[model samples]
Target: MSDAWSHDEVIYPELGRILSESQGERNEEIAYALAICAGYAYAEVKGGADKVTLRKRLARVGLQDNTCKPIELSVDAMFIDSTAFVVRACEGKVAILCYRGTEIADLTDWLTDIDTEPETYSFPQAPDRRNWRVHSGFYRSTRATWDDVMAELASAGPEALYITGHSLGGAMAAMAGVMLRKDQDPRHRQVRDALKAVYTYGQPMIGNVEFARECQADPFLRDNVIRHVHRNDIVPHLPPVATGPFAHFGTEFRYLNDPPGLESPSGYWRRNASARQAGMIDFALTPWEFVARRIPMAGSLVARWRPIGAKIEAVADRVEKAADTLHVPFGRPPSFVCYSIEDHAPHHYIAKLATPGVLSEFERERTSVS
Candidate 1:
């Protein structure tokens, strides 16, 4: 185990208190805490920590009274590879299931992510079981662990359940949420009712339009599945809708990096254009800045010559203004072409959510809703 995970300080202070206080309601605090859990799921897999150790880590973060032990499940079968962990919080009043994201070194994970082939999706309660289509890889992965996940949920018997994951895991989390909610088994009714929300970060589209419509038609699924897309994160744009029957459903909360604020879907393109323009300007200025720093006398000379400096600044400003006028229409170049993979890192989501500004906005919105 790494020192970070082993440290005594609470990784997520007041998470238990927040979960208990919320009483299964979806709130910013719960979402923030779950993001931490999702990130920890990655750590748990990477560090190869056993359940006892994982429980200790969870306890350190304030999930102190988990009578139901944490359970980690790993599945590696014909094109289906995934790792996930389930644990109870607030004395089993809340259950959290976190799926591990794709590891760069794992070929199987990459294959699973890129497998865009569509497959027939049929659940007992699905409105049009025969016509529903979903990503083949994600479907298989969710199916592989469905029985085990349901069994754990039954054992935990939580009043509210939160499902979360990052990257590829996020995709599976969405699928699992749908499966659980659509399950017709009377034995799993408690599991379905206990599902408070599905939270995902940097997730990709998991199903076709028909499947998406199914999610939209269902009141609970429509309102509770929340997707967080970090600024210019590339993963969420995978398996392009133009290339396949893939589509994304549920509410989305997009966080912008530049100026650092939440953005609506309608404003995504404008924000992307601005961010891209800023990046371009920065790239253009870097060479000059580097040369000025490298040539010590050059910087002094530029400073001494006010006209030359003023002229340079004026030209740069003009360029920036001209760039601002150039609009990059949504889906013109395609998001994957311009997005940054680094923005999709799990830590970014964790850090962004914990930021005071973002939390304040979330809190204000929550308060308004209440």
Candidate 2:
């Protein structure tokens, strides 16, 4: 809606409206969208590009450069350091924490190593304050990413604290929300209270049924977490309920490119969801198909930063093995394949959000004015 992005034909009406003006949480929503752009920035790093390229990539996506240098931080969690997890602020108010998705070089292998049956871990800052538990793997990964991100978020004192990612990053973003929401750090009570919204795309279930239930059972926490899942995207349903009882948290926004009634809901999708639809995803990925179609192309067109080569064959083997496991007892459920690799692309998400028709009435009005 700003003259800056007027040239973009597929304006994200809601996002466009937010960009044009400042009001209550308008900037907050805009900030969340910007976080997705930043998430892609981290994802590009997986291809082994340098920081200058990262800055250029951010600019290409319409993000203004940050004036403050100290706030640009990286994660050092148990899984990965720097690139895998990063917190960057754009346009001042929106403080975004981005978690990078999986990459071919150890990316597929790392995902394959994820514990099917995740244990529960208590918050290190809990006990004396509150008793909350999270997926063992997610909690450990969060600590490794940053033990005190909650602390930093509180100190920022922004109107909204936006946490986001795609694929694995999405799951981590949700986990980060859980940790911050239940944070017992007396000093961070403000940050915990300051959380306004959480957005994730193509993310998987970060916890089991218990985790989902706990989050849904609470009204305050429930409203703040929103998930944008492309219909039939299997990445959102992985670890298959067969291997684990993992379920998702947050309100679901299901969009399949012009599907009727997929508009913003007045309530949670889980409580109001209709029957499942047939999957358009093709789960049959041959070793060659993965290496040829999935791996190298995982990096978006914006950057050629890929970790490619002969090692990809090994990663492709893991992909086949993962496909096998996606089936029974320890693999994917019969319904899991309903979601496919094509639905998981981050660019598609950005494109979908930008579609003009998805805008609300107010968004449309703003578009006319702009």
Candidate 3:
């Protein structure tokens, strides 16, 4: 057994040797360790940031758009075979197309493979109602798009519709569900009532108060919408604000604490509220910062001009920073409370308000006809 083989796993003699010998493998190893350490120090870290560094990393890897223009592309191009996966997952079900701005080009593969016989179209373009002051381009356009998608779904048949996406895709899926409930067309009503579940990972908030409440109003929708958020993944908390009253409506929030065999980096990014405030100084300044600095300018487009980029950066940074602060779910009093997963109410209570019980159990007793 060599000194480097202390445990079952092989060990590098030194950092320099590992860097030179391992090459590309070293960076991933370091990142994994950093992710783990970060989890332990998460509470003490200011701003309660998650995925802050990861987002920056992704930006470095050329995964962002620097253009300040509204996104208009499809949802299939963002991930590996994302569109194909979406199609496989959503076959037969009438799908409501929702997504982050106009970055549809990223999703072209998915769109191209869609069965042309059952057509799909887009929502009218407009600004998002949630965070009204901010121009997210999710609200008006998505609302119109939902109406059209619903009409098509109704025509197809009264059956469940599948909603899917990552990041902006996820947010769009949430918005579509909201519109499904808000509208009252006879065809829409039938389709909405018979809707299938929405499963979106890393979704951002889409609408404001009215839309959220509408989504929450439907018990079916609320019960059916499941959102999965990675603990350190920052995309889900973007564009800031709960656009609607039930922004978290019909969306069962699932927290992925961390991957089992990963480590986080030490040294948290201090949550300097002052720095955050500075980031939001004005649109005239700091437009193209961080990820925003990288979008390829189309022709002589002023959208990609340096000055415009800086202004956008300032706003985006503030929104990102603000979102970081609100990561924890609202309403649970901060304290050291403990209980087993199997505990019930009263003597063995879980939270002050709840105990171990399934929604189905509650429903069964309530619906038992006397």
Considering every candidate listed, which one attains the maximal TM-score?
1
Higher-TM-score candidate among 1 and 2?
1
User: Candidate 2: lDDT over CA atoms?
Assistant: 0.50
Query: Is 1 or 3 the stronger prediction by TM-score?
Result: 1
TM per prediction:
0.70, 0.62, 0.37
Pick the lDDT winner: 1
- The CA-based lDDT of model 1 is what? 0.66
Query: Ten residues in a row with the worst lDDT in model 2?
Result: 266-275
Report the C-alpha displacement of residue 329, candidate 1, in angstroms: 16
The digit string of per-residue lDDT tens for model 3 on 1-370 reads: 2242222221112322222233221132222211221121111123222333423322222212111111132333322221111111112332223233213342442232221121122222223433222113343334434544554556555243445444445555665665565455665677666555565544445544344445556675556665544322333433322221213455433322222442331111111111111111221122223223254553234233534543454465566656659783333221111111111111111011111121110111122232
Candidate 2 positional error at 162, Å: 0.6
TM-score of 2: 0.62
C-alpha positional error of residue 6 in candidate 3 after TM-score superposition, expressed in Å = 39
What lDDT tens digits, residue by residue, belong to model 1 across residues 118-234?
Answer: 878785675444668899888888887778878888987888788899998899999998988888889899888878789888888888877887888887777788888886566
Candidate 1: segments with Cα more than 4 A from true spot: 1-14, 20-26, 44-57, 67-77, 126-129, 258-337, 355-370
Give a tens-digit lDDT track for model 2, residues 50-166.
345444344433444532221222333434332333334444455556665554455432542264446565545333643344455555555564554555555566554566677
